[model samples]
Target: MSAQQRRGEPPPLPEPLSPLIDAHTHLDACGARDADDVRVLLDRAGAAGVQAVVTIADDLDAARWAADAATWDPRVYAAVALHPTRADALTDDARAELERLAAGPRVVAVGETGMDLYWPGRLDGCAEPSAQRESFAWHIDLAKRTGKPLMIHNRDADAEVLDVLRAEGAPETVIFHCFSSGPEMARTCVDAGWVLSLSGTVSFKNARDLREAATLIPPGQLLVETDAPFLTPHPYRGAPNEPYCLPYTVRALADVVDRPAELLAEQSSDTARRVYGL
Candidate 1:
């Protein structure tokens, strides 16, 4: 291979896949080129053994698009809510709109919501903690009213997020969509009976915190997700992620917990079904 080819290495060989769910992904963002594009993506995911998928939309347009996609594909499900960063974007009219959307067939969960302090100073109009808190509260209420799990996305705001959740008496089955927190938070979440959905970062070379957290989590409280077109698991780290790439993450998770990959797959899938009501 040439020098350039060698420098841009491909992901490692994928591990054997087991039946699973891409519990959280942005299918609207990844495969919206056309219907055929979506079909191809679904075909690839199906071939890789992803029995189901819960596609999340951070805004009204994305939510409507995701619902339509689910209509086109039986394997895809939908979740509708304003993301933390875009919380202010939601209008009063959206309440009724989302209520209708949530009632759609296979529409499950109410998130990709929660506090995001990672880019506190960046993103105009997003640095305010109160705004994110209000959004988080709205989502919690949405979950309660709709009877759907709240899929969370916490980044650098763990303590405050937990505090709000506790104060509000959040739903019984909240999920930390892309659980990137350390062992301390993991223990608290597990103790609270919340599901921690692991992502590609678990397979990264320097993800010691994630590995430690994984070790402490009970099997029933654990789940896996690709967060596709985002956290592509190791070996596929630099490439666009898809549901098919889930096995690489599963293999890493299995290694961390010292369980067989197949068992992890089954347990995580079961956990996803139970949490998301899939």
Candidate 2:
């Protein structure tokens, strides 16, 4: 019995009955923002059938917290890397620290790193494309050296992203975290054997392209994520998103792929565990 449900509480609904894994999230960021809010979030998520989550921290501060959080719970894992939008804070010292943290046992991957041209203006330290490229390369190299999967966060700069990744040949288990792209791009990534992780955005009525992307991914390569505290699914789109709300997104993904949610949950969860080597 879980805390959310009492013995007589309608038998707890069975939680959609699937082994689902949220491949990308920011538990520490959301948790620290509200003073241990993540624990309640994770508890709710567990009740909803999410077996595990990989929380990513894009900066040093977030990295420290994520590492510590993972230490506190086996269901939580961490990924340390500088996000594209935060590329301005890049320093040799920061890189060194990230590298050190990446070596930690809980650090399962090396990213949330990539290009983000969607911002109105360049992020403070990442104003130049060259510097962003250099930083991306460094992270890629780190992934290779560490033998960890590389998680990516792509924005408007798809072409350059493809170019850089192709040049670098990407790590073996490359993933497009929070994948929000069109059909053609999804096809490209799928053909490249990259994993495409869908988030709450897929549940949007207007996200036709992303829904199309869901159709292209096979069970072995598909994944689901919350990217929590942001991108809450429909019906709860405006509320604070946590892992508990992930089922809504998963249900939406099932609709896109024309499969039942239970099977989709099993497939996506298995795929995610394989990718993260869990």
Candidate 3:
């Protein structure tokens, strides 16, 4: 389906709360092609109390764009890496470029990297499992060397991802962006001092397991994100998502964890700032 057809309508903004930060998003994929577009999106977010955002890169071109996009606005930061599906593209030249980008002033993390067993057999051109593991390990080392957080993107390969992290020795800060696992994994990550960045998926009516997991996470170990242009949250599930929509997820998370929305928002934002070193 085309983007327009898939994104039926932009959801109405939720009521503003304490300042929040969207720990993960895709400004380029969300249709912010230039500085002005970036400003417009961020302005909407700011009005809804979203103070900052971290745009994530899933490939070489996106890594370059994310690093540059961070320069577009003070509120924007970046995380750079090749997605597991595109691990084959991480050639020697690409690795050198990513190393350079990871050292950029606005680059805050090295990630969206980890195992993705779900796509290997189902999606054409998806990287083989072996390639994904090799690339994930390289990205982990890059994160450690750069002294930046490791932003992970795990999909149906939780065990494999954890095993690789154990083998490679995880970076000081590891974030499971758009964390989709249940309470068991949540406990495992929390016990290991890794951050779990929850997304709109936690708000779905059918996400009882995720909601349960949310209750298990300590405020300092938790975060909120839009992962926008996807996972638009419950009421607006099929609609296009953006940073401005973060308040909805924050409120939903507050409900799940039985905390005041403003307090949760503040805590999550603080966690984001610390994790990204913003």
What does candidate 1's lDDT look like per residue over 100-211, in tens digits? 8887768888887899988668777773678888878888988888888889989999998998898888886799988998999999998888889999999987989988
Best by TM-score: 3
Q: Which has the higher TM-score value, candidate number 1 or candidate number 2? A: 1
| Model 1 misplacement above 4 A | 1-15, 125-127
What lDDT is obtained when candidate 2 is compared to the true structure?
0.81
Poorest stretch of ten by lDDT in candidate 1: 1-10
Local distance difference test, per candidate? Answer: 0.82, 0.81, 0.93
Per-residue lDDT tens digits of candidate 3, residues 175-260?
99999989999999999999999999999989888889999999999999999989998778888999999989988888988999
TM-score of 1: 0.93
Q: How far is candidate 1 from the true structure (C-alpha RMSD, Å)?
A: 2.4
lDDT for model 3, please. Answer: 0.93
TM-score of each: 0.93, 0.90, 0.97
- RMSD after Cα superposition, model 2: 5.4
**Runs in model 2 with CA error above 4 Å?**
1-17, 33-38, 120-126
